[model samples]
Target: MLELLSFGDQGWGDEMLLAGLMTILVSLSSVCLGLLIGVILASFKLSKSRILKLIAEVYTTVVRGVPELLVIYLLFFGGSSAVMYFAKMFGYDGYIELNAFTIGTFAVGAISGAYSTEVIRGAILAVPKGQFEVGETLGMSKFQMNLRIIFPQVARLALPGIGNVWQITLKDTSLISVTALVEIMRQAKVAAASEHEPFVFYTTAIVLYLLITTGSNKFFNRAEKKFSKGFVIEEST
Candidate 1:
């Protein structure tokens, strides 16, 4: 068993390690993109414009309602075609090919963004109306009020939900194997098949995932505590 895992030409450790790094990179990129998309969608939902709200609602509904694997398949197979079609309108007829990593990141990010939208929207709504009124009484503009008063509270409230979304995003990278990205799960499968020892490689993949998720949980926990300080006051007896 150790021989198969040794870090040399005689083993698969280097390949597995590189795959683990790819998994982390994919997860981080997807989660960050998801957060950006989430903020946009949440803002749309909160806007007074009915059309904007409808757009946001439809995006979240469709993405969340569809199976994740199906979403990945659609993006993997059609994304480049969609891009090329748009490019042709500008008289650029060359093929636009998206790499596996790009497709996988976008596919997973869209999924994560759908969930994050609800969490962020709810967090915004959870803020007290009193705060807005106070900002108005102080003669603050809407932009100033949102920037100074509302944004912090919303971030603090949304962190926990965002952490959950991060975990989901991390696991979702496994599905990206179909796109031919050599992330942890893909490397494990390859190793297992090559060595005819599925158990060993699969277990290695699990350990790698657990290490990442566990570290993520700890980081979020500390962040929550830090952000909550002073904002959370003890009730008087």
Candidate 2:
């Protein structure tokens, strides 16, 4: 048992470790992109234009409603088609495939971003209307008001929700197994098939996931505390 789990060519451990790292890489990339998307969607949601709000609403609703695996499949195939088409306009023609990593990141990121949109939008709304009024009265530009006054508070309030979306993004990467991305789940499947030891490899995969998630929780907890500094929250007795 121990030898089978050993590193180097003798064991399957290295592949498992590499796959775990891939999972982390994809998760980190997707979640960061998701945050950017979330911010944009939140802005659209907050915009006064009916069209912008409708666009935001449609995106969030469609992304949230769709199954994650379906999104991966759609993006995987759709992305390849889109890329191929764009390339043709430049007089280049060849079948192009979007790598699994790109597809996985985008699909998972889109779903995470949808959820994050609501979280961020709510956080923005949670900021007092008076703050906007104050910024206006001070003749602060929109950029200055957001950069100086609104963003920090929204971030502080949104941290917990964002953390939740991060977890969801992490778990959702497993769904990318269909894309053959060589993430933790794909690695487990491969190892289990080759070694005929499904239980062992799957358990190892579970442990790896737990370790990553536990570390992430700690990091987020520390971040929340750090960001909350100088601000006091009242607790009911």
Candidate 3:
């Protein structure tokens, strides 16, 4: 077991470490993209246009309805073809390729965005209508209001939900192995298969994942506290 974790060519410790970092990088990028896309979708849902609202609703519904594995498969195969076609349109299609990193990030982001749309929309709705009136009375522009008032409250309200999304995104990264992205789970599987020590490699992978989840929980807790400070809530006896 110890030999399997050693730094020599026989061991996969370094590969697993690098894969863990790649997992983190993919998840982070996915979360960022998801947040942006979710915000846009949420805004569209909240918009006055019926067409825009329907479009956003259909997007979230379709995405959430499908299995995540299918989403990754679709993106992995279709994304490359789409890129190549676009390159051809520009008269430069010599096998336009997207790296595994891009594919993994986007596939996870697409899934994350579906969930994040609900979280953000609910958070936005939680804000009091009176706040918007107050902003209007203060001569605040829509952008200014969102920047100064709505965004902070949405961040606070969405933090817990977003944390859940982060956890899901992290776990979903395991699916990226199909795209040939060498994440921790893939590395562990390879090591276990090669070394015939499934227990050792799998156990190590679980511990590493647990460590990441625990550390992320701590950061989320700190953020929650920072945001909730100075706001008093009535406790029911």
Candidate 4:
């Protein structure tokens, strides 16, 4: 069984490595896109306008309420059709094809964004109201205030929650196997089916995922520590 995973023409080592890399790439892309969406959602929720707040709330609630597998299926089947319909409206007769990778990233991002919206909004609200008041009193523009004062603190407070979301996004990419993107889990499935050794291949895949998650956790921990430096309190009893 071990020899089957060896790096050779007879082995699947290279394929597995490539698949693992693709999984990481997809996860990273999805997380970045999700963060962008989350920021927009958080802003909308925080806005004074009732209409915008309602829209944002509805988006988060609906997305979070739905199953992730359903979301992936919707994007996989519907996204291409929707794009083609839009293209027809623009007088383009060509089909604008979105590959599995694109669909997987977008689907996972939408789900991650729903969770991230709440995390970000809570983080933003955790910042004392006095901070915003001070920024206003200093005559800081809204953008300047957010950039200089609000965003940094929110990032620090939101890191742990975002870290959890990142892990979920990474694991969620496994579901993209349904769309045939050939990420780690898909590759493992293929190998298992071909070799007729489901336990060996699946076990290896699980170990590989554990390794990736362990490394990612370390990075997040380092980031948290770096950002938390100088703010660590030494409690005097």
Candidate 5:
């Protein structure tokens, strides 16, 4: 049993490790893109414009309401047609091919973004309004206020929620298997089928996922501690 997982062609260990790396890379890319999407959506949701708010609402509602696997499938199967349609408008008629990796990244990012949107918006709202009022009273520009006071507080408050989003993003990458991206889960499936060792491969995959999540948890905990050190309120006797 151990020989099956040994390195090189005789074993699937190297391939499994490579697939694990791919999984981490895809998850990281999705999380980064998701954070960007979240920031934009949160801004829209908090904006004064009714149209922006409506758009944000619809996006979050749809993404969050749908099962993540369906989202990945839709992006994988429908993405090419959608891209080709836009390409035709710009004098390009040929098919616009989107690889499985791109589709997986995008689908996971969109789902992660919906959750992140709420986290960021809540963080923004959690900031005391008086901080902004004080900034204005002191004649500080909006940019300065956001930089010096608002964003820092938001980051600190949003850390835990962002960590949750990261965890979701990591797990959601598994759904990308439908797109044939060959990440950890897909790799495990292949190895299991080939070696007739479903239990071993599947258990290995589970352990790898736990390692990633556990490491992420520690990282986020440290980040939360770092950000939480911003202000100190001392009592006078």
Candidate 6:
């Protein structure tokens, strides 16, 4: 086992390590994209327009209801075709390949965005309407009010939910192995098959996942504390 994990051509360590880093990169990219999509979806859901609300509801429902693996498969297969079709429309020809990394990241990010929409929308609503009124009274414009008051408080309120979403997003990247992006799970599978050491490689994958989760949990915990630091309630006279 030690020899298997050694850092050289005889060992699978270097491949596995690079794959682990790929997993982190993919997960982080997905989370960032998801957060942006979530904001847009939440805005739609919170809007007064019934059509916008319906659009948001339909999107969240469809994405969340489908199994994640199925989503990845659809994107992996369909995304390429769709891109090529568009290309052909513009007088371009030949196959335009969609890389596994792009497909996996987008697929997982779409699912993550669905859940994050609710978390962020709820966080926005959790902030008291009176705060907006106070901002208006203080002569703050709408953009200023949102930037100075709404966004900060909403972020604090949404931190825990976003942290949970991050955990879910990280684990979901394992499903991307089907797309052949070669994240941790993919590398482990390859190593196990090549070396006939399933137990060692699989266990290593589990340990790597745990380390990521633990580190992320600590980071979020510190973020929560930082955001909550100045929060205090005074006793009414």
Candidate 4 stretches with Cα past 4 Å from truth are 233-237
Q: Candidate 5, residues 1-237: lDDT per residue as tens digits?
A: 888788998998898889889999999999888989999999999999999999999999999998998888888989999989899999998868899888989999999999999999999999999999999999999999999989988988899899999999999999898788999999999999998999999998998899899999999988877777756523447
Compared with the true structure, what per-residue lDDT tens digits does model 1 show for residues 1-237? 988888989999889989999999999999888989999999999999999999999999999999999999999999999989989998998978999999999999999999999999999999999999999999999999999999989999899899999999999999999998999999999999999999999999998999999999999989988998877633559
What tens digits encode model 3's per-residue C-alpha lDDT throughout 196-226?
Answer: 8999988888988888899899999898888
lDDT of 1: 0.93
Q: What is the lDDT of residue 52 in candidate 6?
A: 94
Return the clash pairs for model 2, or none.
none
| Cα TM-score per model | 0.93, 0.94, 0.94, 0.95, 0.93, 0.94
Task: Single out the weakest 10-residue window by summed lDDT for candidate 6.
Answer: 227-236
How accurate locally, in lDDT, is each candidate?
Answer: 0.93, 0.92, 0.91, 0.93, 0.92, 0.93
Q: What TM-score would you give candidate 5 relative to the actual structure? A: 0.93
Better of 3 and 5 by lDDT: 5
| Per-residue lDDT value at 62 in model 5 | 97
| TM-score comparison, 4 vs 6, better candidate | 4
Model 1 bad stretches (over 4 Å): 233-237
- The residue-by-residue lDDT of candidate 6 on 82-170, one tens digit each, is 99999999999998999999999899999999989999999999999899999999999999999999999999989989999999999
Cα RMSD for candidate 4?
2.2
lDDT for residue 125 in candidate 2, whole number 0-100: 94
Error of 4 at 34 (Å): 0.7
The model with the greater TM-score, 1 or 6, is: 6
Q: What is the Cα-based lDDT of residue 39 in candidate 1?
A: 94
